[model samples]
Target: MKKISLILSLIFLSIGLLGCQQSGKEEELNKEISKSTQEITDKPTIIGEIVQIEGERFLVENKTEKLPDGRPDAVWFSTDEMESLKVGLIVSVWTNAIEDSYPQQANAKKIEINEY
Candidate 1:
């Protein structure tokens, strides 16, 4: 009975410590995100056109596609998220690349297409 009580107490103690550590890590992450948001919010944006469209993915090839400066050959994203992106359709996209996953996609957060 004493052994079982000791084991349960140790488990509870470990869980409590882990929970506290995770909460601290979460707060640290939130602070980092807030700092990053402030840095990017000051930058000017390129509101470019949708050059191509695919299933759940769209491309907004900026005119200066010559440089290796992180512009997409074809931007890709979800039509559900950016409702204006349909096949053979042109739309304006606001986005940035993940950097780690380069060339394959330039992920767009917002899209707007011209209506007739």
Candidate 2:
């Protein structure tokens, strides 16, 4: 009877240790999932100077950022406030989605022209 009890206790202890390890792995996975979710939900903002304009869309050059081709990172944004925007003006644009292409493109959700 004693031998049987010892065997049962060892089995239970092994299971308990495995459960704790699995719990830790699950916690780590949850943290990673939360981090990625936040990144997906956050809207990206671009701050740069307008370099070109075509109708309601304009190209912005971010001097601080660069593309793999050694050109300054640029984005073309379509906005209804084109009347208030012009080349050489610095602006901040909030966007929901950006297309992956040379001179990335996005529709501006909000635009703020820098006066100073």
Candidate 3:
């Protein structure tokens, strides 16, 4: 009877330890997920020259960095913030990412003209 009780206690202790470990892992996973979500939703800024403007969208050629594809980086902006923007004009754009697009498009939150 004593041996049976010891075995049962061991089994329960093992299960309790496993449950605690699993909950800790889950909490760590939740924290990592929250951090990743924050990064994805965070706004980013870009400084570049206007390559083209079609309606309210501006095609910008990034001056500060090249894209991962080894090509000069470009981004599209959607806003009425700067209506007088002309091609080759330098500007700084603040934007939020648009989901599910290649070359990564963003909706312009603000635009500043760096050149007159």
Clashing pairs in 1: 56-77, 57-77, 58-75, 58-77, 59-75
lDDT of 1 by residue, 49-104 (tens): 56665676765554555447665454455446746455555555554433334334
User: Which has the better lDDT: candidate 1, or candidate 3?
Assistant: 3
Give the top-scoring candidate (TM-score): 2
Q: Total clashing residue pairs per candidate?
A: 5, 0, 0
Model 2 misplaced stretches (Cα beyond 4 Å): 1-44
Instruction: Name the best candidate (by lDDT).
Output: 2
Instruction: Summarize candidate 3's per-residue lDDT along 33-102 as a digit string, tens digits.
Output: 7754543223347778998888878888877688687777777888866667889999887754454454
Would you give me the overall lDDT of model 3? 0.77
Query: Model 3, 40: alpha-carbon shift in Å?
Result: 13
Worst 10 residues of 2 by lDDT: 35-44
Candidate 1 vs 3: which has more TM-score: 3
The TM-score, computed over Cα atoms with residue i paired to residue i, of candidate 1 is 0.47
TM-score of each candidate structure, all chains considered together: 0.47, 0.60, 0.55
- What C-alpha lDDT values do all the predictions have? 0.58, 0.85, 0.77
